[model samples]
Target: MSDSDEKPEHQKENGEINGEEEIRLKPFQPWYSVQIKGASKNGEVVMFQITTVKLEQCKEEVEVDRQYEDFEWLQHCLNIVPNVKGVIFPPLPDRPIVSAAEAEAKSRKQLGTASKNIKGDEFHKDCRKLEKYLQGIVRHEAIGKCEALSNFLTKKEPPVRAKLKKGILSNLSRAVDGVRKGGHKDIDEMFQKERDLANDMQKIAKETSLNFDTMVNSLCRISMACNHLSTALCLGMSAEDNGASAIINKLQVEFAKSIDHYGYAVDVCTANDENTLGFHLDLYSRYWLSCKEMLFERTCALVQFDNASKTLEKAKPLKKPMAEAAKEDAEKELNAISEVAKKEITKFHQQRTLDFQKSLILYAEAKVKAARDVYALLAKDVSTIKQMDVEFD
Candidate 1:
């Protein structure tokens, strides 16, 4: 072949770099492997250190610090709110809780009393939740492949959150949204039932999470009481070198050690349950809320379609072209959303089953593991006492 007619060596099978017969790259929806390395808060705003890579390209890893607001912006860009696209956006993680101990420390610092840091491991859980949220958004086929997602993952600068609509516009939007959500009669019985079920499940799941948290707190108090008992026993022990008094002191010290171990075990095990079971329950509540919103979006489309059909009928006799065109657009939008929602609902149910099953199994395994941990801690302490040189001098 002539040199001018020949393709470049590098572009041979890789496709033409530049020519009339240029390479037509096949389209691909890239999956991102995302992780939240850490999270930190500045006042009310929390920023996450996120690292992500496009698994398909094996491109250079992109690490960026993103505020929670940035994530909200990403969702907004994907048409999550107003959800006119019939997409169920992944819910953001709940904000960190300021425990009573931490709050008291804050109060002390505010009043200028010397206070030490007493923050719990809430950051760890928050990081996990945020990571999962990112993963969910990226895993979705309907919305994940957007260029906005790429910018969110790779951009060093934060995305600008749009200002909330206020005054008349806000009121008008809310009124319209409310009518759309409530005005339409549900034609699909399955969807109606699913909506009610999802709402009920969300409520129960949230309450269950609170109950678990309360139980964990109560167990924590019990653990503290055990520690106090151990300390009291230790302090009450006699210092005499030999005789019955000495034997009694030894017994008190040994028992006190065992009590201390028990207290530690309770702290460890209950905390595990709190993180495993309680965390997932709270997560479910948020997910259900998003799922419900998706259904509402579909209903909104249905309401629009219903109104358009009425308008088209009125216009037909009058020969109004604009009204007929508007009606056609509405019908197209409604049909698109309906088809999308059918797939979405089925996927939602399937995912829900897998998630709940995994979470429940983990909770059960945690319970079993906690029980064993307590036994081991207490047993090890008691064994030390058993092997103690007990013969009187």
Candidate 2:
């Protein structure tokens, strides 16, 4: 009830102090207000309504009005909370970008596997197609040449010319159809038919010297066609083997032996007489030489295809397993850029080495043929000189 007990003006009721006790007023504590800025879908800046709440209670409690809106609400109490005082939002982890070389290598490996499988299936089909086309070309060319030669040799007899054309066309048609249908069960069967036809034509020529030119021309055409067919078969076999077929190596050996046999036969036929020799040599220089070149080119193409196929096949086994392993390892340790580069370079070198080996084989074959031709020509010239001397004696 004394002066010391009087209430301050701010705390007094009705401008008068209650006689019981003096009431003290507490000091005001500062509160911070936060405004969150965000973007809207139409590229306009949107201001969010200011929110007031304790910083400690702001977790998962702040609701954004729009799903796509960017916003954050931090109340005063939540900001001042001991644990939230130094809170920092971290940026997202960056995604790993694959290098172009790595991507290309992977694509090549996959494409190679696919190409290998596809090419295997296509090899025989393509061989058959090529055989048919070549047979047609050979028959047409032979018939035209034989007709001209028949006119020169047989005194232009219509009957003989007709017979020759009919026989050649019939044989060629049969061979082509057989090839198209994949009807030849074995190389032996195909060659047997070819040999029989050749022998029959040879006999016809022997019976009539007037028809000799036509016969020789026909023989040359037939031999060239056979050689082409043989090459195609060999290529198909090689492709099959590369495609993981068990028949590849076996076919390759068989075809090589067959080629050798044909080579010998051609040589024997060429050695028999001057006319036949000239015919054979001319055919060899034109068709066989070109064919050899083509074979080399085809070999290179097939090798490329095979290399791609093998790489792809090799990569297939590694894809899932390697990627999984890589992923697991990646989780433990991020993949270094250098590791990827090394893998790509290694694969490129392997492909290059394979291509080089294939090219070497093709080059060697060409060189061997060139050497054989040189020796054969020299021997032919020597034989001709000896024959002339003997004639004079």
Candidate 3:
């Protein structure tokens, strides 16, 4: 059809004057728009623009009708809306969260371990100190016995004095030999030897009123001191090693029971989250709990050892007198016996004390190593938890 024939009646008046039809355009509306400055995995930035919708709803519903044909190279400048609320990312595995109960259990284990170690260390130290004190007592007793024998020899009349002196010397020699052998079967035997040496000295001291009285008094004093020291040392040793060990063992047993409780808690938490996560959280909880239990047990052992040592220290001073008395009559036959007993006690203390100290030192070293290992594992677990949180966020 011809252009004139197609013209409507509205333009008929202008048709004779070569009239043309006019087109109408709508008014632009102000709208909220976001200019994205950065690109996210799931969302993109809009360089510039205004739209007639809320940014919140526009992200999901806004549409672009105009094509940028003239500015083809600027296509990247056009703002695009994302369908999702946040940046799109790959799904991550759900990480197990450490629960309050699990944390508490672990802490308890760690605390127990630390306490045990401290106790053990203290016990060992005390034991060593006791041993040292006992050794001193033994040496003092030996010296006293020698002096007592010399005094007895001086008091005796020529032939008798010589015979008594030889007897005293022979006894002293035997006592010394016994000590050097370090093979006494019983503590009583050792004490009996000391008593014998004291009696010999007392006998000689009784021969002359003035000198004998003085010697008797000295022998009594030394004997009393040695007896007191021995008693104290024995008490201390028993308390430190035996008593402390018993207490630690009990505590450790309790700690082990706690582990079972922790395990149960973990199992519950794991079951609760198992369906959602695809893996068992109880496994991690149980593993960590096991570590804590081990640490607790070791600590208990350490404490027991420490307590034992402390007990020994407490006993050391108590037995000082007995040790001293044994030394005073070292020269007397009876004094020689006391010296032998004192020496044996001292030797026992030294060996045991040394052993305790060594054990504590080794335990501390192992504890530190284990702690470090645990820390590394905990760090890894925590990192995994963080990553999971980020994914959800």
Candidate 4:
């Protein structure tokens, strides 16, 4: 169609015709209005109730009660979303530190020797944690823009399970089918070995996850301790502390950078390990099941074919040719089925081999990157310490 001819006609002033105006739709922009309504506590654990209002014309309001773990889960959920790949979320608070005295008190409380309600001082502390968490997330561009985070804030529903892309297993699917038909004991043995290896990797991933969490919390604790030291130095030295305060301040700044670096790493490397482990475990489970089922089919086909062959062999020469014919037909069909099953078994094994190879490469890369990050952080810390020592001298 010609450009002008295809245009819709519109009447304008002075009897002139003009093309129709194009209509454009704006994308949805969502904002949240949130408040920490209150908190509930058991002996050891506490949950904060949050109230959220979505500030659109609809003005939707949602109330949810969550503990610290729930907040961690929310952040973890956001990390896996492919749509928000480059998004960086704020760090969650470390676990509360309970001194020996506090631990004794908690133990007594748990044993019913003390009251169950949270102490006023402790409640206020927990409240502050909640406040900081809310402030951090709401100001984050990535977390703030996330639909899952929005749902977390505004709704009381079960978390949506993340679906792995079809491509994740496309390479392994056919090979898995082959493994089923051939009923090869060798393939099954290899699969078992690989599955064991995957399990071991999963265990390592979990340990690394815990260690990274500890690293973040440790950095936070160290940062706070340094701040306190700086305050003490300034207070004790009064105005003539030489250069103690300046040195302390410099040290604190360095620690702060280290904390920031580790925090970002937690969101990137730690979160990535969590996601990859889940995907690998799931894929392994499917592989195991497929191999087991295919082996069973192949075994059954072989048994049936054997029985048919034996029946045909025992039949008399000419007395029952009809019976003999039926036996031959049964043998042929079962033998064909057995052959098909064998082919499938081989195909699945090939695909599975490729899949495992790819998985190994991913795991290796992740491990190397994580190691490098730790090395870099430690090196920076050492350099900062040397500088601090010179200032002290």
Q: Among these predicted structures, which one has the highest TM-score? A: 1
lDDT of 2 by residue, 1-393 (tens): 656666554567644555333343332221212222232222232222222222334421232222111111111222233321112111111111134444455433433433221111112222222222222222331121222322221231222212113378898975665354333222234333433433354444334433444444444444555566767766666444333354455545455555545555553453343233332222222332222222222223333444444555566664756655544543322123223323433443364356446545654564467557656765654554444322211
**Of the candidates numbered 1 and 2, which has the greater TM-score value?**
1
lDDT of 2 at 8: 59
* Superposition TM-score, candidate 4 onto the true structure: 0.34
- For all predicted structures, in order, the TM-scores are 0.78, 0.17, 0.18, 0.34
Clashes of 4: 11
Return the TM-score for candidate 2, rounded to 2 decimals: 0.17
Model 1, 1-393: lDDT tens per residue?
A: 777666576567455445434434433355788999998777766678999997877567889998766776787777843334766678877555545666666444432354343435467777888888888888887667777888899888877777644599888986788665754677788777877777788788778877877677667667767877999998897777688778778888889988987888788777777667777777778888888777787778777777887887777556678888888888888778777777777888798788878878888897798789878877887887888777775
Q: Considering only N, C-alpha and C atoms within 3 Å, which residue pairs clash in candidate 2? A: 54-78, 55-77, 55-78, 55-79, 56-78, 112-308
Top lDDT model = 1
In candidate 1, which residue pairs clash? none
Of the pair 1 and 4, which is ahead by lDDT? Answer: 1
Give the per-residue lDDT digits (tens) of candidate 4, residues 121-180: 345445555565565566544456577677678667646544534484785875675555
lDDT of 4 at 119: 25
Candidate 1 stretches greater than 4 Å from native: 1-30, 41-45, 80-84, 97-118, 161-180, 239-242, 313-316, 319-321, 380-393
**Native-referenced Cα lDDT, model 2:** 0.35
